[model samples]
Target: MSRRRRKALPSEPVRCVIETLSHDGRGIARDNGKAQFVDGALPGETVMAKFTSTRSKFDELRAVEVLEADDARMTPPCDFADLCGGCSLQHMSGESQIRFKEDTLREHFAHFGGIEPDEWVAPMRSPALGYRRKARLGVKYVPARESVLVGFREKRNSFLTDIDRCVVLDPRIGDRITPLRELLHGMDAYRRIPQVEVACGDDSAAMIFRNMDPLSDSDRQSLIDFGQAHDLHIYLQPKGPDTVHRIWPETGEERLSYDMEEFDLTMKFHPMDFTQVNVDINRNMVHRAVEWLDIQPGERVLDLFCGLGNFTLPLARSAGQVVGVEGDDAMVVRGRENAELNGLSNVAFHGADLQADFTAQPWAAEGFDKILIDPPRSGAQEVCEYLTAFGAKRIVYVSCNPATLARDAGVMVRNGYRLVRAGVMDMFPHTTHVESMAMFERVDN
Candidate 1:
């Protein structure tokens, strides 16, 4: 079969006025009845954009120069903001970014769910910069430059962006990008290392280097030295996720922890475990989820898609009993460990395929009085189908994707629940990713 050739982009930059912003933070403009997605441009701004890609329905462009800027436009904090894919809305003010996210969520609810919340809660906010506690940084050795690049990929490209520091990441690892590049460049197996996973706790930080090949003894020692000097834990992944092991501070426990002061709980997790990237937002989110659920004393609660008992442990503190269900058995084990560590005997952890019919499970026999769900980007349509069967009076849903959440919310509404309130949370700021929460109450039909 003959392959179709891609249409060549125009050589000259075209001038246009941005009419609106897309969900992914791109500016939408129309030229000759065709839509164009303009990167690095804001709504209501006029720009000269160079065409990067041409498609059948629309074209993709990168704004070369802003002829007129929006009031919300400001200087980006990161030097590589225009090139790095780490953050997309750095040019927009923090308030405007929140508004955009809220508006996106509102649109999703109205379009996908065919419903809206009775009241829109105030958007949950946090520090705009230096809040990222986790990231996977790309590592590449450039022979042409005689240096190693350690940062995010370039916008719309797989190539690593040439950056020295990150403004939004936790300073522990973000500020050390240049030093990390230097250290990797000195290593004998510099080219063998592909990426570094960064995980930061309240008191400590860790870096897991994914080595494609065996590291030399000198290279390993240098990594340890760097960790010791910077007070960062060093881990190495030789093959797979199970192969990740700590190398530095060989004496202490191989775990990092964060404290939920309101609940008086300290959650311990492995460096490779799934965790929220923004700690402040997570803490606030947990608090709001618990408060919104309104778990009365002696009432049973259920937490679905629970990881490491982040909400289950806290919910147990208030409810008579709390059950946490997760798909990953490893996370179930971690949840049990967290429950034990917190001395909460009222909670239990169960592992099950949440996408399937879990109503027949042993834990599901006893109906829950309240429920809390923190699903991933795909959302929980399967579980939402049988949500009201549990007879929960109130439910709180924490979502990372608005479209999926809206779709699932419609399912819940059809199952005899009313959308009470909903709002966006700035879990990931300066990025198009929207984290939101919605409350639902069972109607007494």
Candidate 2:
């Protein structure tokens, strides 16, 4: 087949009046009856934007200058906010951002699920800056700049942003981006280093370098010296995540951990393991979920997609017994280990693909009084159908994607569960990413 030619982007800037914000925080504007999604433009604003990509349905634009600003707009704190794609809502006030997210959640539930919660819980809040504990930074060696760039990609583009620091990331790593770039530039395998994975705990930070080629002895020594100087953990991944191993502090195990003092629980995990990027919001989310669950001392609880027992251990502290189920056997093993580390005998961990027909699983046969679900962006559609089998009185769902959560809530409602209460959580501050929790109760129970 012959190749089709893509249309060229507009050479001159196009004027637009942003009507509203899209789900990804882009401005929704119309030009000549066609919609244009513009980055860096807020609603109630008039902007001059240049088209980045042209498509049949709409064009992608990046606002170059604002003619009029939204009342909720604020100056972005980050120096590279205009270029970096790490955050999209830095220009919106924190309070307004939360309000936007809350409204977005309601819209998702009403549009996708055809229902709304009986009670709207207050939106959870957290600090807006230097709160991220986990991130994946893109690395690029530009010959024109004669330097290595280590940061997020440019807005709606594949090129790295070439940032000196990131305001949203933890200061330990974000503040050292320049030094890290210099260190990488001095290495022989700098060109082969495609990205850096950052994971931080309460006290220490870990960085995993995804190196495409072998590192020289000098590169290894330099990395060790830098780690020692900064008191950080450095890991090298020659290929995949499984290949990640510590290059610095080569003598002992340096597992990363975070403590949930509210429950007297410590969760130890590998640097590559999935954990909340915003630690404070995670704590609030856990506590609120526990409160909504209202677990009785004699009740049995089930936790799905339970990683590192973040919620299972806490739930165990209140419930009579808790069983945590996860798809990854590795996470389940770690969850079990975390349970033991916390000296919790009432909690159990099991491994199963939650997306499958899990109603027949051994844990499913057990009668539980409460259930907790923390699923990924895809949500728990396949498993929502089976939750009725557990006959739990209450189910608290912690969702990172509001759309999927609403979709699954529809399934639960059809299965005779009522959406009792729901609210948005600021797990990811200054970004369009929505983290929310919803409470559901079986009507016939």
- Top-lDDT candidate index: 1
Candidate 2 residue spans exceeding 4 A from truth = 1-6
Tell me the tens digit of each residue's lDDT in model 2 across 1-445.
9898876777999899999999999999997889999998988999999988888889899999999988898999998888888888888899889988998999999897479999998999988899999999999999999999999988777999978988889999999999999999999998999999999999789989898988999999989999999989999999877799998878776689999999999999989999999999999999999999999888999999998899999999999899999999989999999999999999889998787887777776777899999998999998899888878899999999999999999999999899999999998888899999999999986
- TM-score of the candidate numbered 2? 0.97
Model 2: colliding residue pairs: none
Instruction: Count clashing pairs, candidate 2.
Output: 0
Q: List candidate 1 stretches off by more than 4 Å.
A: 1-6
User: What's model 2's lDDT at 35?
Assistant: 93
**Which candidate ranks first by TM-score, i.e. highest?**
1
Write the residue-wise lDDT of candidate 1 on 1-445 in tens digits.
9999876778999998999999999999999999999999999999999999988899999999999999999999999999999999999999999999999999999998579999999999999999999999999999899989999999999999999999899999999999999999999989999999999999999999999988899999999999998999999999989999999989888889999999999999998899999999999999999999888899999999999999999999999999999999999999999999989999999999999988878998998999999998999999999777898999999999999999999999998999999999999999999999999999983
Query: Against the true structure, candidate 1 has what lDDT?
Result: 0.94
Kindly report which residue pairs in candidate 1 clash with one another: none
